[model samples]
Structures are given as C-alpha cells and as structure tokens.
Target: MAKADMEQFIKSQLLKADLIEIDRQLSVTGINDMTSMLLLKQAFITVSNLVDFEITIRSIYREHEKLSSEYKSSSKNYEFAKYLRNKYIGHIKQELIQKSIEWKPELRYSLKRIDEPGMMFIFNLFILETAINTYVNDDGSHKIFESETDLKYPPDLKRFLIYLSSTVRSAISYLSNLANAFGERVEMLDASEQKIEHWIAAGETRFEFIKK
Candidate 1:
C-alpha cells in the first residue's frame, strides 16, 4: 500500500471514530427525551444513531485489509456492530429476537393487593403503562428488545438505543486510539500535491446508504 494511501485510510478512520461518539450522545439525548408525543421522533434518533455508528465503524475497515484486521482485533463489538448495520437499525435476526422478545405484563393489584401478602408496594407507577410496538420491519430485521436482557423498558426504539449505545459506547476510545496511532504513522503530505489515486478505498466498499 502507498504510504499516502495508508495515511489517508487512518485519517479517515479517525474522523469516523469521532462520529461514533457524537452518534452515541445524540442517541442518549433521544432516549432521555422519549415520550408519548415524541415516540417516533425519538425512535428515529436512536435508529439513525445506530445506522451511523455501524457505518462509521465499518468504514474504518474498508479497503485496508491489514489495518481492518488490526482494528477488528481491538474490539469484540465489530461483528455485532455489523449485524446492527446490516439491519440498518431496523432489522435484527428474527429468530434471536423472537427468543429474547418476551414481556411479562406488569402485575396489577386491584387497589387492595398493593400491600397484601409479599407484594412490595413499589411507589413508582408509570401512568403510560402501554403497548410495545415490537413488530418486524419490511426487511425482516428485528429491533429493540433482541439485544440486552432488559425487556421492561417498554418502547422498542428506546430499548434498541440503550442496547446499541451500551455496545458501541465502550469501544469509542479504543477505536479512536487505533485510528490515532495509525494517523501518527502516516507521513504528512502537502494537500495540494496529494494524488487522489494515492488513497485507496481500503476494503469492501459500499456506496449505497441504508434505506429508511
């Protein structure tokens, strides 16, 4: 590989690495802002974050087999990130999802059982103890609850955001360090004299963005 190309590859990866954090923060905000009025909007934020998160990570490995292998070695989250990207933030494997997609209806007391027996009177009551829109999308990918074991969260989209953030948030610094290290190895070049051809796309390239 050309030194310039390697340099650019690393540089590009570093840029994407920064994006992963931005995506995480934005998704967190969405989760925090979730409400009945903003359900779809908030859900979209999470889904959007996941798609971008996966894309940024995937781009790091593109065209550069050697570096990608090294990059992948640093994080156990790579394959899982790809799986999320493949689903485009909507689809998770239906079978896996189906297995994990069980919700126990909140045990309700008849205003009398609130203190009877071993019933713990949990003072917090969700007024909007409502539905779970856990349906398969057109692409057949499952979402939300297929991830972590916390199914009591209710909202499918919010659940997905929490799960995705959990997986990707921990790796932000790890991937960024890899990119920064590679960037350090790349020789500084005059941008005006830089040849476009000198930069390789690195790995399997995808030009198509995921359809919403």
Candidate 2:
C-alpha cells in the first residue's frame, strides 16, 4: 500500500482499539445505591471516552473526505457532542459549577460532590440531550423536571447507556469493515501479520477474533 494509505489504516485501527476499551469499561454494570459513587465515576469515564471517540471520528473525516453514509449521518451527533465536550467535560464553565453548588448546597461541603450520583446523572443527561436533541414524553412534549426527585434516579439511565454502547459498537464495526476493505485493495507490509499474531499471543485474550 502507499504510505498515505498505510498511515490511514494504522490510525483507524488505533481508533478501533480505543473504542474496544471504551466499550469494555462502559459495559461494567451492578450499579446499586452502595456503588453509586463508583458508578458515577465509570459513567463520567464513559462520557469522556465517547467525546474522544467523536473527536477521533471527526479527525478521520478530515483525513479522508469520503466516508460511508452511516458515518456521514452521525455528523449532527458529533457536532452537539463537541459542544458538550467543550462546555461540560473539556472546559466546564464556572457559572455552571456555581449554579450546581447553589442548587445543592451540600455540594459545597465536600469534594466528593463531584462523584455524587445526582450530579453525575445531570452531566450524563446533558450529554445525552446534546446527542439526541431533546428528552420527551409519549405525547410529543418535552419532559419537565421540577426537582432532582422528578428525575427519579434517572429512570432512563440504562437506556442511555445502552444507546452509547450501541453507538460505539456500530462505529467499531464500520471501521473494521473499512480496514478490511482497504486490506483487500493493497498488500500490507510483510511483517504486519506476524506482528499482529505476536501481539495477540502475548495475551490480549479478550479479543475473541484474535484468539480465533
């Protein structure tokens, strides 16, 4: 393959590896009242991973102008995600932080408030709203919340997590297909297969295909 194609293929594969890690971390469950703080941390990590995935996808789009239709359709999600990344995750606004504290005075009592389930739920909900536009009711009206209790421990938390996982898996599948397509079109470096086999044999056993 040409040097440019080789570089692109390698980058795509790296991004695929990242998505795999993100998926694994996000798949961890068993979040109950006792583990709420841990769950919040995991959820925060998942959202950060998702933002990184969006950024990587955007980079790929810039590198290769032509992409599949499904990839193109995700542009809107990435656009909103970029906004959320900057506003909430990447560079949180002081105003927002102050508001959060004012809304929950207990937040001022300890640093652990950052990992509180309620706070984390709001952050996750913000990201989800950005990605999907709006949260709504069956009547096509926007969902309204009067207080934290109105959210009721985020009843849709599982659904949001499932959506995030599905999105990552779909992206990985697309990238895998793209890599295979490129492989069929060009001869890889002679040592590539051996390197892959060695890496797999060295105990990356979680990848079922590699073990196969």
Candidate 3:
C-alpha cells in the first residue's frame, strides 16, 4: 500500500475514535445546555458515536495488515460497546432478545433539577443494569422520575469511553509509526484542518481494487 493511503485510512479511523471521546465529554456539558426534549434528540447521536468508534477500530484491525494480530478484540468493555451499537444502530433488538432468553433489554437515565441560585438540570445514565438504580440527594429534591427506578442507560458509559479514547490515541500513535516501515512520513499532517478540496487539489484518490 502507498504511504498516503495508509496514513489516510488509518488516520480516518483514529479521527472517529477521537471524535467519540470529544462528543462524550461534551455530552456531560450538554446536560447543562439541553432541555428535556433536546436531551432525547441528542442522546441517540451521543450513543451512536461509541458505535462509530467500534466500527473504526474494528476496521483498522481487520483491514490493515499491520494491526490485524497486534490488537486483541476481546473484552467485556468492547463487547458492551458493540452490544449498544447492535441494539441501537442495528435495530435488531427483537432478534437478539428472541434468539436468547437471557438477553433482556432495559434502559435508564437520571435527570434532576439543581436549584443552586440559578435553575439547572443534572443528567446521568444508568443503562444495562439488572437492578433498579437510584441517585439520591441528602436533601429532598424535585425529580421528574422516581429517584429509584429501573434505569436502562448504562451509567458506566463515561468510564468505558475513557478507556476507548485512550486506546485510540495509542492506536493513532502506533499507526503513525507504521509509516516509517514504508520509508515515508505522514505528509498530510493537517488532515483535520483541510477540507475535501485540499485532498483533491493534492492527488489523493479513493482506493479501488485491481483484481488479479
């Protein structure tokens, strides 16, 4: 493979991984800015970002010869990530449920008002837990839903994403070094800064198969 193509494809996946990290951080910040209705709308894309991250890393692992055996794809954290991707993005919840009796699907989230001088709302997730999860305040606070309720949103999501983000950053660095093996440096250092026109202006073309 050519140096430019290797750098481009690998970096592309790394970007997706990095973006998922940024988006999740912003999601916490989002709760402060988002209204109840807006929360519902933004939630899907936020969760979907993890799904995108999964596909990116998997692609780099499978398609790239260098990373194929180097990265192990086995982990509960990784599986949970793919499970969410499958449930929400794939839309095969019923199929999964019907296929296995143990696979029960539930969703939960925590939302509460924080009236500290200025009115504000705090949002958190408690997804995929078997037992009803609760977020309690020492003082009684107004809540839209019961404090202790069967919540489905995975609370561990934020933590899981932290693992993912760090992993991807490592992968990006690892991928960059692969360029040295090709006897070339990553020429397109400012890929994020450039628009599609920049690549077109340069000579990067889409990868096409040449069957033997």
TM-score for each of the candidates:
0.36, 0.53, 0.35
Give the best candidate by TM-score: 2
Candidate 2 clashes between residue pairs 3 or more apart in a chain or in different chains: none
After TM-score superposition, the amount by which residue 53's alpha carbon in candidate 2 deviates from its true location, in angstroms, is: 9.6
Q: What is candidate 1's CA lDDT for residue 161?
A: 56
Residue pairs clashing, model 1: 62-202, 62-203, 63-202, 63-203, 64-202, 64-203, 91-141, 92-141, 92-142
Higher-ranked by lDDT: 1 or 2 = 2
Candidate 1 lDDT tens digits, 135-207? 3357654443343233234674455556455545544544455455456556667868866555655344658
83-196 per-residue lDDT for model 2 (tens digits)? 445555566656556555555554466556658756655544433343232333576554432212222246655454554555567667767765665555465547545666
Candidate 2 similarity to native, TM-score:
0.53
Q: What is the C-alpha lDDT of each candidate?
A: 0.43, 0.51, 0.40
What is the Cα-based TM-score of model 1? Answer: 0.36
Ranking by lDDT: 2, 1, 3
